[model samples]
Target: MATALPAPAALLLWECAARAFGLLYFPPPTSIAARAYHLWFSGPPAHLFLTAEAVEDLLPSLTRLVVGWTLAAALGLATGLALGRLPILAALADPLLHIGRAIPPPALLPLFLATLPIGTPTQLATILAGVIWPILINTADGVRHVHHAYLDTASVFQLGRARRLLYVIVPAAAPKILAGLRLSVSLALIMMVVSELTASTDGLGYRLQNAAGSVDVPAMWAVIVLLGIAGIAANGVFLFVQRRLLRSGQAARPRGHVLAWQQ
Candidate 1:
């Protein structure tokens, strides 16, 4: 609800609200700002840009996020395509996939930590395992929803494997892929932080936990705000990409003529 405000009004409202009551639970916004500022500026390393305290904290999280999500995307898309296009595979795997996807990923943290490598590698592997299911499941769903007419047209043309996949399958399945990507992106960030909070020595999540333990509530709150801001910014970016992919996919088609339509 607060997001609907015009920028000026939002700032004003935020200031007023914080001044009125925020100190009861959190430091007012200014206290959070002071903590954020001191973290980034009150240091000699500022010239190196790692002076930002959370640089040390945030980098590991970002690293795990990027690596894990990329792996998930690659594997998920491949698996999803097979599930969507192959009847026997879909029949065999769909039920299990549904059940697996429904299970919360963090519940497996104990199992993962027991078997996976330690430190950064373990964090990344944990994030990947946790976040991958949404991408895989959504991509499969999207592939299944591909327009039937498109498949029939490809059949009529007797398209070769390369041509069929390049022209028909990928294009037809793109909107769904983009949707799945959005879900996976959010999942990736969540898992990245959760992994850190659970075990990693460094990360925004770790710092937040550390600050809380030290009773540095203002710093903890600042980190939480940053996480919220990061989530918003990431979704904005995903939406921008989604618009481009959707538009480009549409533009690639001969919308001017309908008979040759193939997804």
Candidate 2:
């Protein structure tokens, strides 16, 4: 509640200022709220509180966002683990990885469009390229720093490679991995909007661009507000998962401590 208080206060301030200034371009917060309700939720609550426009516009963007981010996360984790486990391989790829990271993710959109058929594939590629780096880097670094004592224990216990990775390495590196994931989630949202704005017939970004082009300021602002809400929801959910995972990891640590002590 303390964290959430500022948002309402900020909105109240915005509403007051916009109303007082009577700016033609800046729709008062109240007007934006009403517009949002009409555009997305004026329909009967029986329809899961979604309107036609939202079904057409919002859902597709969300689907693309989820798919792209999931793919990036998986790829990043796999690649990071590989690199972290094999220092030689990481050294071999370091230059190439750095070069790729240097290039801005959105700048590759045209290349992706040329290579892949338009629509979802292109958008996914763009978002993945944009957001994968943080997770990849963080995971690699975290896993690389895993205490050598842990690896020695795994070896002494004759643990299989899979068990070492899943039961030992991943949990040890989870905090840093989650930090990277949080960053990538924000990047994914930003890239999603950018990809839509650059090329797409529909989605929140397209709608935002369309509103701006048509001088529909209130509608534009409403879309921005909706995007903010979506981002907040995503981050909140992910943070909850991160906390649960961390707690589980903590619970498992004592067993490892006992084993090490016995060894």
Candidate 3:
């Protein structure tokens, strides 16, 4: 209750300020919510509550965000695991990875645009580039920090490389990996908006930019609020899943350790 009040309280203050000042630039939260409803949710239930504009703009943004983030997660996990486990590989790749991580994803947008056409691929590439680093680095760090006792137990049991990684290292490192994923998700959302703003006719970012340019303050505020809602919703879903998975992993861990130690 305490946590929830601040947001609503701030919004109420904003409403009062906007109304009292008759501010044309900063529409109140109520106006923004109404604009959002009119733009995206003023539809019959049969249509799944999304206006045509939502189908045209918001859906594409979400699709790109999911696709790009998924690809990054898969590749980052694989690369991170390999690098984490193999000292030789890590040594060879460390410098290159550092260099890559130092450059911002948006900085490479021009190269993406020049190489790929100005479309989904380019945008996905840009987002994937930005979001992959945290997952990769964090996963690698987590795996490296896995208890040596676990590895010794795996060796004593004569567990194959694949089995050891899947059963021991992954489960132990999952908490940190998931933490990285949360960061990656947020970065993915930001990159999605930025990529659209840079080169797209539609999506929330482009609409926000267009609204601002056209002096549609209410519409601009509506887009910003929608972005915030989307971010909070995505994070909520991820954290819920992370909690369940981690709990299940923890439950199974003692059995795994006992079996490994006995062998």
Candidate 4:
């Protein structure tokens, strides 16, 4: 949806021009597009065919992403909540978080390679570990940022813990929590491909690395472009959801003129 404009065409023109100068490194636009088309519309890609059909590929990568990212999200939310609500826990773990996030996920491949068995499982773990931090930190910060006034209001109303959670704390903190997940959604995908780059026999990342390895310019270019599109689409979806949720939140706020209530 984001690319449904004349601007993409302009990019295609530039891509074509870039290729003209360096054919070896930069394949033509039509060639890359054709290769991308082949990935989706061709035949069974799991095994060799007369030609390529990559349309089915999104499912495998997405399945891994769903599993890994969901796990990360669950952990992130739980950890964020605990840390955000408890200063002591936050103090204990925040430093580790700051340190861990500084290291890139790819740099850890050698460690994973040596420690974990080589296969799909390792890839899943890589994506999960890489993506979890955003969720954890964001949720904690969101939870921390929950207004004291809200808590006080809940107390005055004699609201039960469940009611307080449902009506006050969650609403106040949800935007930031979602913000973290939004970030992880993209981070998870990048790591998903990165995992495949080193570990997988299949998937888009594998296709990209293999293409570069064998000099299949078309296929390499194809997967790279598709990956770019996928990343962009994921982010766009997150932003759209965030805006919608924020709008709903605004509408749900208590609406009344201030009649000058004094404590």
Q: What does candidate 1 score on TM?
A: 0.87
Tell me how far the alpha carbon of residue 81 in candidate 3 is from the true structure, in angstroms, after superposition: 0.9
TM-score of each candidate structure, all chains considered together: 0.87, 0.91, 0.92, 0.85
Regions of candidate 1 where Cα sits further than 4 Å from its true position: 1-24, 45-52, 256-263
Per-model CA lDDT versus the true structure: 0.79, 0.89, 0.89, 0.80
Model 3: residues >4 Å from true position, as ranges?
Answer: 43-46, 255-263
The 10-residue segment with the lowest total lDDT in model 3: 254-263
Tens digits of per-residue lDDT for model 4, 1-263: 76687788877876878767776777777777787676675665554442344534566687888898998999888888889878998899878989888888788877888889986778878997899988988888888877677777779999997798778877778888888999999999989998988898777777788888999988887887877888899899889999999789767755431111111
| Candidate topping TM-score | 3
Task: Work out how many backbone clashes candidate 4 has.
Answer: 4
Model 4 alpha-carbon drift over 4 Å, by segment:
1-9, 15-22, 44-52, 256-263
> Pairs clashing in candidate 1?
none
Could you give me the TM-score of model 3 versus the true structure?
0.92
Over 74-103, each residue of candidate 2 has an lDDT whose tens digit, in order, gives 999999999999999999989989998899
lDDT of candidate 3 over 94-148, digit per residue (tens): 9999899999889999999899879898889989999999999999999988877
Better of 1 and 4 by TM-score: 1
